[model samples]
Structures are given as C-alpha cells and as structure tokens.
Target: MSGTSVLALRLAGPLQSWGASSRFTRRTTESAPTKSGVIGLLAAAAGIERGDDARLAPLAALRFGVRIDQPGTRIRDFHTAHHAVTGASMPLSERFYLADAVFLAAVEGDHTLLTGLRDALRAPVYAPYLGRRSCPPAGRVDLGLHEGARLHDVLQSMPWQASAWYRRGNRSPQALTVLREAGPGESVQTADVQRDQPVSFNAAHRRHALRTVVTLPVIPGLAAAGGSRDMHDPYAALDAFDAVEALEDERP
Candidate 1:
C-alpha cells in the first residue's frame, strides 16, 4: 500500500440510486454504493468538474470499500419527459432506488490527499449527493478520518450506523457484508468483476474499466452495538414518563 490513511463516510438516505450501468431508458441501482459513485461524490466536493480527468486520476486510484449496515428494500418508478423546444412527448424511463438504506464507505490513500478530501466534504465546493443529484445525503457524509489506517480496518471498526427503527426490527447479531477492491495476487476466478472503475467522468465520453472485488463478511459482533439501546419496546421509555408528568399536565 502506498498510502497510510483512510477516510470514512456515512452514506445514508431515504432514497439512493447507484447505477454502474444505465441502459437506454432503463436505469437500475446496485444494492450498495459503487466505487465510481463515491469517487464522483469526492470529486464534486473538491470542485473538480466532470470533464477534469487529470484531477480525478488520483481520487480514482484510492482503494474503495463499503460496509452494508442496512440493505434497504429496492423500489422502482417510471418517469416521462417532454421536449422543451419541440414540445414532443419523450419515451418513458424506468428507475430503481433503495429506500431507507445506510452504508459506511471507506477509502485509503495518501494522508495528505485524504485529509484534504475530509475538509472538502465538511464544506464542499459543490454539494455532495449519495449517488445522484436527486439523492442527497440524509446528513453529513464525513464520519472522520483515520491516520495510518487501512481501508478495510477502518470500515470494520465502525459502530453499526443503521437507523434506530431498522435496528430494532433485526436485533440479532448480524454480520455486515463488505465489498472491497481485491488486493494484489488474488485468483481471477475468486474475485468478482465490476465495470465501475472510472476512466473518465466526462458526460460526453464517460468510460469505465473492470475491477476485481472481493466480498467479505465482517463485523460479526454487531449485536454489541445494536443492543437494547436501539431496541424498540412500547413501554421502554415509561420510566422517564413519570418525571415529565408535570409538563404533560400543563398541555393546552
């Protein structure tokens, strides 16, 4: 590894769409965030224009991985548009999205580069989105930056970041599924391939190359972080209700 730092991001939203490939009028989303999508987010935060391939090269070189804290359900919708000048009806399009999903995205690279990215994320030159412009992050994307840390290690050490309600329903100790770029010297048949490795973000000549990805089940002890605190019981807060009785009596 050439770099020794990692940047962590908490990517959660009511609706997110990460499409590695878009076919004509049909756009489908992946179950988790893709490397190219996250790189696009960082590039936008740094104010790098879509056509600036030189600046994006270093960002694309960073190792990318994501922990699926919560794999929200997939939903679809259809959309149609009309030509602005001609006022002619356009073909209908189908789009898919993930609802109520939460993810922990991590990238490891040079310390200086990662630190700059962390700052840009805090106050981005351009607004950041989950995967598309329509799917803005529910909250801040910067969880923190880890100096002298590796990509998978930082991702594995984070606490469960799922929403309160979602964790309550699934109280069991769960093993989070992690998808990360494979390390050097892995067998070709063992690693999966994705064409999301960005070659250029230019809308006119957008291109991607294949990448080897390895799936690992990490964070098996999620129950420690998903204990009773996140569990939902109808009367779980009744003890505190007694102290608020005076305020309740004054309600108009």
Candidate 2:
C-alpha cells in the first residue's frame, strides 16, 4: 500500500437520511448521501470519537462520491417524545427519509490509510448508521478495496449495486446517476455547490463547508446507448424486496 486507493461501499438499506440543513424541529434529508455524512461514517468505523477532530482530518480529506443506484421514495414521519430531565413533552419533530433506497459510495485516498479504514469497517468499534441513528445499514458496507485506483474510475466501472427487484423493472447502469466530486479545475458553473464538506465532527461544534458536485451517467462498459427509462413508483417494489429477503433467509 503505497499510492492512491479507492474504498467502495454498498449503502443499500430499508431507510436512510442524509440531512445537510437540520433544524430544531424539522430534519430533512438530501436525495443522496452527503460527503460530511459519509466521512462521519468512516470516522466511526475507524473508531474515531465525535470529539476527536485530530483523528478525523485524514478521513475528511478523502475524495467522496455516490451513485444513485435506486433513488428511493421520500417519506416523512412525526416524532414526539418527553424530556427526561423536565418530564415535559418535547416539540414535535418532522423527519424525512429515503425509503427502499440503494446507493454505491466510494472514497479515495492514501492506500495505507484506506486499508486500515477498510479493516476497521469489518469490525467497527462503533456501529455505522445511515445519516441518523435510527437508520441502520441492511448489510455489510464493504464492497472491496481498489489499490492504485481513482474515485471516478471505481464509481463508473463498478457493477450496478441496485437490488435484484430494482433490476427487474429498470436498466441497471443505464438508469443510474452518479453524483461525484468535481475533477481538478472543473468549472464551478457546471457543478452544484452543497454545504457538506466536514471541517470538524466534535458534537460541541460540528461543522461543514461547501463542496462542488457534478452529475454523470453510470455507463461503464456499455457504449453510449440512448433511451428513456420507464418511470415507476419508488415504493412499488417493497413487496418484491421483502419477498427476495425471505428467500435469501430461507437458503442454506
């Protein structure tokens, strides 16, 4: 492990919430995973605590990207609770999540550092969650480690990680969208600016800066093929996904 490497992740789960702008009573989620959120996840896997910014800096500097393999439905919920100290009812919170979504995430950086991070994920000190604590990963996050690889190459060339149910009705790579960090000297006019770059993860003063992102197609081995994707309800495949899971569980 001497040079650059990319660590890919499979981020499919029953629910996910990547909130960039969270308020006191209303928490909203971004459509895809955020850099800050994903970095925080890696830090947790590496056993870095919330207040340890010194250990968090290297993970934060890694380039990040995510492919929307399955852009799940946005659903909302109302949360009500009581304050333990005061025994008073807390204000109602309106929370949002992406249900039945599957994402492919990747981070690129020093090979030696990435290797240790991957090993830590295999046996994490603190469990990883989607953007919120209530949402957990449906399965293992590790995809594989690609040495001497770059983020763009790994994200685009990897096979579509969408669920089998999603593949039945949709083109895997053809219908997918990749949201990635801008390349060197990429025009700011072409990329969308979002406030997700993590500066610190200390609970007392969590901070994030802005980063530019560009959207592209997930056409890897296939030649440029032009066609329209069939529009279907994001929640339409719930039953099928459940059925598939049952079959998997029943297998020896």
Candidate 3:
C-alpha cells in the first residue's frame, strides 16, 4: 500500500467573527487564517491539541489552497461591561451586535490525513466553520483528487480558465500570455514597464500555483519523476489519496 494526497476544501457562508481582537470599549475584525487555521482544523479532526503543533507541523509540507467564496461583508459590533459597587461579582452588561461576514477555505494535505479529515467533516465532533460561531458552512466540503496515470500527469493537464481582464502588450510579455505564446514547460520574465507592466493577482496566482502543484506529485506509491517526490521513500501508504480515489470512484 502507498500513501496518497488530496485537496480538502470547505465553503462557509452566513455571518462570522474571527474575534482576533477585543477590548472593553473597542473591538476589531480579523479574517481567518486560510493556512494555519485549516491546519488546526485538521489537527482537531485528528484529535490533536495546541501542544501538538510541533509534532504535526511537518504536515505543512502539503500544499494548501483557500477560496473565499463570498468574502462576506464586514460589520462592526458594540459591547459594554460593568462592575459591582460593593466590590462583589460584576454584573454582565448588555450585548452588542456587528456586521456579518463569511469565508471559504480549501486545504491540500497528505491523503491519509485528508481521508480521515474528510470523514470527520461528515459528522465532525467539533465545530468546523469559517470564522465565527454565527457564520456556518454554506454547503458540504468540496474535495478533489487528481486522477490519471500519475499525479504529475494529472497536474500537468489540470484545467484552469484564464482571466478575462488580461491584455497583451506590443513589446512586453505577460505570464499568462507567455503560457499562451510559448508551449508548455516554458518560463518567462516580464519587463518592468511604467503603464504596460505585467500585473499579478493573488487569486489568479493561487489557481495557477494549484494547477502546478500536481507537478510536485505528493501522492505516495507513484514513482518520483523529475524530482517530484522522494525517490527513496515513495511506497508509503497514502490514506488521503486512497480515500479520494474511493470517494470519486463511488461518485456518479
């Protein structure tokens, strides 16, 4: 048996509050940590604790992807606290309200960990959400596992729709245009012009990077090609990959 790798994703909506900062008179909002937070969620699914961060930190080697579906609107909350005049227990004050927000996240990890993590999502013992208690997941987890003769092969052929805002220059070259100008496996360095300079977007770059991730071929058992995986240790059993295959195979 060999180990597998898969992409684990979750889409959340409604209202959320990360509660990154809070004070007696003022408060603030913080977006969720797409990388660390998803890892922590996986740790929780694996029954890992805060103290286990070091032990499980190695798992970070796996690639992570997050898609903020709604990017929910931000809102402000208000609150107040009180103290007893007699030096006794202080009475609670009135509750305040804030605006609603939502976020979506996707994480890629080892197949074994991912498989168990996916099962945990079905009936997770803990509450796995985007950011706040009020904001809940909009739908089921969106999990995907590259399928082909090999992981690298699948990644090389993965589909990625180009952005519509792209424009080619007369004398300069762009990353996406380079992808179109040159054949596959080509690289380019765009010139730093004033107005015709190339543009980079995190969203598009994330998608592009994700498509190239399969190039790394994290799935175990597959023979390492072009230094994609560890040549010496490529026969380990991958739970996440196996689970993804099983799940996809069963899907219509």
Candidate 4:
C-alpha cells in the first residue's frame, strides 16, 4: 500500500504530431498519444516488442497528466502540377496549418518501475522522444512525488503563473501564457509573454526534430498497487489501479 513510484518526464515539443489516422493522407493533425502507442514507445525504449506490453501491467497504475505548452501553429508547403496530369507542373495550395504544442507528461506508478524508467530515460536502449524524434527536453526532468493529494490539487499547486518562473529560479526557462474559455464574447487575462527571438528553423531542423521542449509535472500514486497510467481502458484493470477513492464533494 505504501511504496514509491517512478516519475517519467517527457518533454513534448513543437512540430510534434501524434496523429491517430494520419496515414491515409499525407496531412497530419495533433492528438493525444494512444495507450498502445505510448506503451509501444516505452517497450521500444526497454528493448521490448508488442508482445511485451502486457508484461508491463504494473505500469498501469500510474497517473498521467499532460500539460500542453507551445501551442504550436502548423505550416504547410504544397506541390502543384500545371497540366493537371502526371509529372506536370501543377498548382499547389496550403493544405492545413497545425498549431505547435508541447506536452509535459508525468507518469506516476510503481517506484521501482519509475526508477527503471528514469534510468532508461537517461540511457535509453533506443533513442526516446516526447512526441517526435527531433524534439528534446529543454532541461532534465524536475521530478518529485507527493502523497495524500488529489491529481487536481497537484496540478493547481504547480507554479503555473509566469511570476513563479523567476521566483523558482528558472530565469531563462521558457514559459507560455494559456488562455481559457470563460464565456462567449467574454475575455480572460493572460500574461503577455514576449517572444524571445526568432528561432533558427534551419538549425532546429538540422540538430533536432522539434522546435522546443516540454515541461512535466508531479505524478501522485505512481508506486501504489496496480499501475498509474492513463490507459484508455482503465476500468478493465480496476484491480491494479490505485486505491484512491473519488470523494462525493470532489468536482471534476
């Protein structure tokens, strides 16, 4: 009932696409990672294969939270044929634009598993990435754990305000200001974060797969029995889930 959990820090980045059904068209869109895909990534890092996923049942108990940053904007280049036939110069059009976004993922689960994952991250059996191969974490994982706290409470407690960045000593740390929906025709205040400078897209393309890195969060109840994962079919694995009870007064 009492044990430590592993904290896997994923630094998501801009230009990363986690599309579910993008293969049909060359066009891609942004979406959350699928359970199968994420687990597959983990398995690959561990030098495992598809069949090994079920063996990682212990990881199922982890709690996962994705904090999106860098809400990226998409850019597209087109090719056109002039003759409207094969191999002819044609007109090109902007297919679509996708917003660049970053995700900070905290995986809270078994302490031993977390430790193993942390170690694996440092020296991954295979090169690992947040959402794409090009992006890298801005900094090393700032990981920790907490007990007796709900997931929502932990999220709110994190220093989300822009001022906290300087106060927390991340002077040069990249930050973003998020805008939320209040109501129609209503406005919310967001800290106007100035763009630091023009990023060298060429250099980013050459050195990395993505433009920026992602920030992660505190994962609670990672090491408890079962696992702490955001598995889509969590109800199917209830026995292994953390024993945290949903309170009547708790708001979703």
Count of clashes, each model: 0, 0, 14, 29
lDDT comparing candidate 4 with the true structure: 0.39
- Per lDDT, the best of the predicted structures is 1
After superposition, candidate 2 runs with Cα above 4 Å error: 185-189, 220-252
Candidate 1 lDDT over 34-135, as tens digits, reads 999999999999999999999999999999999998899999999899999999999999999998888989998898998899999989999999888999
Model 3, runs deviating above 4 Å: 1-4, 18-27, 30-33, 80-104, 142-252
The better candidate by lDDT, 3 or 4, is 4
Pairs of residues at least 3 apart in sequence or in different chains that clash in candidate 2: none
Local distance difference test scores for all models: 0.85, 0.84, 0.38, 0.39
Q: How accurate is candidate 2 locally (lDDT)?
A: 0.84
lDDT of 3 at 179: 11
Order candidates by TM-score, high to low.
1, 2, 4, 3
The deviation in Å at residue 59 for candidate 4 is 3.5
Clashes in candidate 2: how many?
0
Residue 163 alpha-carbon offset, candidate 3, angstroms: 21
Task: Write the residue-wise lDDT of candidate 2 on 1-252 in tens digits.
Answer: 499999998886789999997889999999999999888888888889888888988998898999887799999999999999999999999999999888889999999999998999899988899998899887778888999998989888877776656666775455568899976665656778899999998878888898888887766534321112222335558877999999999999
The reply for model 4, stretches above 4 Å from the true place, is: 1-10, 31-37, 77-100, 134-150, 161-252
Give TM per candidate.
Answer: 0.86, 0.85, 0.44, 0.46
**What is the per-residue lDDT of model 3 for residues 1-252, given as tens digits with 9 covering 90 to 100?**
136565535344444444332444454444433343455455555565545445455544444433222234566544444555756544443222223322223444456666666777766766675544454554454445532123232322322211111111111111111111111364535421111011221223311111221111121112211211111222235645798899999999
